[model samples]
Target: MMASPYLQCDSEQKLQCHWGLLLPPGCVVIQTSSSLTKMGCGSSIPKNCKVGGKGRKRHSIIEEVAVFVPTIRIPVDSDVVHPLRGLVSKELVDRLSKLRAHVVSLSEEIFLLTESRLEASVEFRWKTLDDDQECCVSSAWYEVLSVVHMLAMLALFEANLMLIPKDGQVGGERKVSEDAKKDVVDSLLKASGCLDYSVHHILVQIPAQVKKSFPCYLQEGMLEAISIQALAQCVEIQLGLASECEKATLSVKRRLACELVTYFSQAHYCLSGCDTSDSYGKKLLLFLKWKCMEAKAVAYYYHGLVLDKGAEASNHISAVCCLSAAEDLVTDSKRACLSFCLASPITRVPPPWGIMKNMHKKIPDAAYRKFQMYGYLFEQDKNSAHQSLPDLPEFALSLKPEGYELPSTDSIWDNVDSQPQIQSLKEHLNDEEDEVETK
Candidate 1:
């Protein structure tokens, strides 16, 4: 991958964006957009095929991870291969248990042991989402944990995408196996837990002086953008499960849809308040826009279904408007999705999986069927079709951030702490530090 301009801003405080794959201590990842056009579920949407709303399709989406390169006080000087982040993005399903163990080992034994949070004096730089041009720099070790956890979540997300069977048929969406659905759910929950740990356990502890240097991604709001969106996506998959069940009720479907809306809108609300000056942040916000609209559409469509059960003519009119709004939102969301994919560092939308895999086809068909049934409203102009639909009723959140805690500091630190040692900064930099000269 080509290097970023920010990589040169401070030669010693370098960065790399590759997910830390068996990362060496002295070097960091720069913002390199590894081409992802053909990888996992992140590939382009199939044509002419009706989609299941399993995934909100995108043309392309950028992925990022980071490593810091500097000659300053080193936080992690030992070679650390993060288990989750180190696992090949694909072929990781079998390794998840081991991956979890590694997460604790690396976090407590290696990462926390560095105590970069309290003692590091050198600047550490890391790239943020979606953008390769800018990076966040800090000396605090917690920033490393926050970013590493987020990056690991992305690594696991790919494994979930890979577990989903391919959708190649032109006429019908394939049935997702229960095993696949369970795996997806389990993986998503783990991913959410990773971010949960970062936001609550790691990011919260950053010293006040360190907080001011944070990028929007490191801030609570944008981190929520990542955290809650994972939950929303998880709920989207569950909604698909409900749709597949012959016994599931409209209320069940409606509840899931409402929950999806709440989760995505919560993420969007958090994203909107943060700075998006970077290219990655801008695309992320746009993608969240698409997600919010899609969830709203799904909720309205199901809500309209339940409302239509009532005998009142007013109920029928409102149902008509809800369906109308659903259709509009679907259209708007598609446009917004396109905008996200077309933004800088282009990416393809993953193939549809879950209910959304079929959602694209289902919504339009349902809306059309509902519209015909409610035709009399429009025929007599009972209410203007242009009138806004009712806002979605609020629902209690169905998903919560998986609880997470950093592993306790490794016993290795006990030995190191007992012995006192002194080393000159000059000697540390000259002998141990990987000092990079810009020239």
Candidate 2:
């Protein structure tokens, strides 16, 4: 249950609009008293006007809201990633639902505001995990929709990490209670749902012309990796619970491990389409590889146990080989884990807490037992049969990531055309712009 250090937001766009002459004469801003509301301007910006050309500042009669986009930072040179606004966890889903609503409302507002060039585009700036600088995409409102969704999902995931229960010490006895695990499972599912929408739904809505140009954060491959990463973590947590249960069978544990391997390997494969040139990508690849290797260790160990129950000599030999492979994989994964921590923008690796932590205790002892069973046979038979690792049995995944649907367009958009004063305001603003440019 390790959390990525990449959290927080430095990507901000101050969104302010003067509505005195924009929206219909009586239109008032919908949001109030929150991050979105505090910045929402209900009238003219005070600094932009001075009473009788004196120094006194007061907001004019123009009703408006100041706008801001909280973009997450991508720290390449430093290891500081900040969380979005506050812990969005308490109201996160609602907050996210409102984000699309806000974007929809803003798009309509912008269209009315930009009477001059209906071609005016909103700039969406964000950064990928590996980059030092923020990336910008200016186009349709869906661009903003897509980026905001990514940030929301990321926030949800980071919050879920905070929710994970920690045992007092890192040891072989996995004693975390089932009740605690249940909550994290719910959070993980929500995170996966956001990720599911990011790649599958919202992404496709982005205009094709600007789609390919989006930063790695919005790209299909990276989104896929994050999505699967969430699922992998969920499966890991579930496996931890299963491992702790006395009633659980060997097959059930192996099934969970095999599924974990499925997610980690798929996530690693997604990285193939991404640009691994950046420090983040490189570090991520190492992490995925570590996870993949670790999953294999747990999977093979449980598989060896299941096979050991069979009656035939071949079964025993195969079980011995599986156990041996599991031991070697455990070693390999440890090395990979160290490499991940030592990568640039270095940070401490999370202490082993879940399945791998418990497996560490079991693999050596189990392998010892398997080898002990085979000792007499090797001594009795001069020519021992060659034993190579057998393929781990594949099991159908017990879990599937939930799908997400974007909220319907904000209700405010329904009355966009009904605002008669909007046209006159656009012409008025345009006329003012023309006078300044002409002068």
Candidate 3:
């Protein structure tokens, strides 16, 4: 018989059993023939455990084992750089460059169109025209005027675009390259040329056409309105260009100043001869009239500035006269427009339509302020010039406001060299007048 390893024994017997030293107190261990068994000490024994029986169950011992897994980490590069690195792509830059080029090309095309129209108008003549022929000639003239106006606007737009700063420019504070400044000045000069072309090529022909056709072209005020408007625009553009380029030559500035005076005088005369009875035509005429007055005031102000910069004491006095005349014109135009508006039936309505609503209300005040500033500068120039030439006679420098009047059409045309055909037309008109006198 095999002895149980868990059996409790006396101190003398405990010394005989070698396995007894490994057991805890009050614990019973079961030993099998094949392997060693351990059972916990408790009040009730498990059903799987048998005590000294013939059918003793064999107990098996299972050992626990631990295994380790090797872990591998691959090192990654964190300093990779992008190719573009937040910069604009070459493709996008090329597209923007192309867009600017396209705008320039378009402006040139419009300029050419205006020149062609002006040529056509200059070549045209009136010779016993029928109703259809008259209409055709009138249409052609209107087309020329439209092209001129369009060219002027496009040139002005191009000039403005050139003035705009590129990206990274600090609110136009960044110093532009000298070439860029010259380019802006050139653009403005080109715009001035376009305006001058309209006044000289188109507006001057109106009187000749009126004389040739008599009552046919002068029925409505549209042609005259357009002519005056063109003249006003020409004066405005010249003044703007002169002001923009401070380093411009004295001769160039003087020419522009004289041209301004001539154009405004021409516009005033043309408007005076216009028929303003047609409601639609009157609206356009009124708008053109007020704009012409405003532009004339500004032109005079700029002319005064130019004159004030001149070497002559006479120029300074002339500058003051111009400034004074500008002020008077602005005030008179404003009062006239206000009175006209008040007397019109459109004022009684909730909102006036047509020309009444579309009138340039701010022109008067703007012109007034501009002239006032120029007037102060003119006074300073006059004082400086007077001090420099203390011996100069006052009567020699004095400008009579009444003496300033619109020159004759022939005289105005003569001042600026006209085309050969235009000169021939003037001669023909003179011959007709001579024949009428003979009759």
Please give each candidate's TM-score.
Answer: 0.66, 0.68, 0.29
- Candidate 1, residues 1-439, lDDT tens digits: the string is 2221112322322222222322223111212122122223224223432122334353332432110100001112222212122222222312222322333222211232243332343233333322222333434354355444544444344434444335533333345567655655555565577667676766665676777776555666766677777788778878988988989999999999999988877878986677877664786677778778888888998998898899976678778788878888888888887787677655454455565566677778877887788778766764564345777777788788666544333233344342323446774465343333321
Ranking, lDDT, top scorer first: 2, 1, 3
lDDT of 2: 0.55
Residue-level lDDT of model 2, residues 1-439, one tens digit each, is 4323222112122222321112222111212112221222212123454312235454432221000111233211110111111211213223333432443333212111222222123343434322235556554333434433543443443434344333323222334456646655655565566667666655665567877776555567876776677778788888887887899999999999999999889988998978877665676688788889999999999988999898877778878889999999998988987787677655455557677666777898889898998856545654656366888888777666665443333333344432223235776577567657755
Collision count for each candidate, in order: 31, 16, 0
TM-score of 1: 0.66
**What are the RMSD figures for all models against the true structure?**
12.4, 13.0, 45.7
**Residues 1-439, candidate 3, lDDT per residue (tens digit)?**
2222222223324322322211111101112212212211111223454433346453331211000000101111111112111222233223323322322222110111112232232121121111112212332343333333433333333333333343423222323344544444443344344445545554554556543543322332333334334443434444445545668764554455445445445545655665555443354444445545654555555555566677765665666565666667566666645543443222211121111122234334444554564556556665554323111111111111111111112121222222222225775577567657755
TM-score winner: 2
Candidate 1's error at 206, in angstroms? 1.6
Q: lDDT of all predictions, in order shown?
A: 0.54, 0.55, 0.35
Candidate 1 vs candidate 3: the TM-score winner is 1
Rank ordering of all candidates by TM-score, starting from the highest = 2, 1, 3
RMSD of 1: 12.4
Clashes of 2: 16
